[model samples]
Target: MVKKRIAKILSFRYTMMAAILILLAGGLVLLPKYQESEGIPAEQLLSNIISLERYVSTDQISDKLISQDPSFILIDVRSEERYNSYTLPNAINIPLKKLLDKEFESYLNQDQYDVVFFSDDNFYADQAWAICNRLEYKNLHVLKGGINKWFTTIINPKKPNENMSSKAFELYTTRKAASLFYGVVYPDQTKTKSVIKKAPRKIITVKKKKKMPVEGGC
Candidate 1:
């Protein structure tokens, strides 16, 4: 009888211990690793930036333009002067400082256009990305290498060396076709526009290291 009573007590203790363990596990899982105090946390931003999905390449943008992809929405985040000097066809100007304008909320917050942001050197576009990301906006992207890359590759494409791989030749050909379609003559080196390139996956400059780390339709 004593042994039976002891066994019952032992079983009850084991059950209680198991319940406690499960509750602890659940609490830890529910806990947020880092709080999003103001803007997006560095961890989340770093992860998203590293993921190349957040960036669109010049080739991709060009193809979309040639196809007359109405779903694509290009936003030039440079000054009005630069935007006026030369901007993508059908692109809208939205300076970085004015990104949070209430009027733009619908364009950004809506799900219709595949919004792509570009600036001279990816600086302003990245800032815009961070803002839109904080707001949990969807279908937003930064133009990789921005307009500088577009000019170098599509505007006035340099001929690849004979020794270069066929892929290089093919890419240049595609760029040539895109230039013609866009009505841009090659070798327009005098032209300049605010642009940005997608950041490299990692930036190992001394104490910090960001590991290298987007989607589309129509």
Candidate 2:
């Protein structure tokens, strides 16, 4: 009878232990969700988790170019060969492998520019982003969807959906209308208004003729 009573107590202890473990496991899973629900937006939380300086979408980049925002510096993180084939105009080519090199140290440390990174895929770009973040370089951002997304979205934007809001549809329509009107959908190649240089005036020094009255007297 004593052995049976001891067995019951042991079983109860094991059950309690299991319940405690299950609760811990559940808390572990729900902690993130609960934190998300409490206050901060998920994007901000993710940025903090990844230690990103900022996040930018392809459309935002496109619009920035269209608006001629001069503070942006676009960097292509693809291979040299891939960059040579084609890249966004004015984008400097710095391959992912060489981003950490001393030669690129200045490029990565710029405080005046909003550096945007892109690659054929997000993999290399994200790697570069992480490297820069680890180095504590501020004003860095990743071009969402990378080059592929750039091709699909900014280069050739598609209608979102049939049920998209009228305002959204009108915005898209305006974009299309502007494209047709300007004959240039992308501002990567748009030349800024040029300042005309004025020619310098030529200064002619005329030597005055000395009076010849003294020579005539001689």
Highest TM-score among the candidates is held by which one?
1
List clash counts for every candidate, in order: 13, 0
> For residues 80-180, what per-residue lDDT tens digits would candidate 2 score against the true structure?
99999878767999998889889987887879988999988677888788778666687788887788876665556567698888877876765554444
Q: List pairs with backbone clashes in candidate 2.
A: none
Judging by lDDT against the true structure, name the best candidate.
1
- Candidate 1 lDDT over 29-112, as tens digits, reads 778755636666678878887787888888899999989989979999999999999888899998888899998788899888
Error of 1 at 183 (Å): 1.6
**Against the true structure, what is every candidate's RMSD?**
22.7, 14.2
| Total colliding residue pairs, candidate 1 | 13
Model 2 weakest 10-residue run by lDDT: 195-204
What alpha-carbon RMSD in Å does predicted model 1 have with respect to the real structure? 22.7
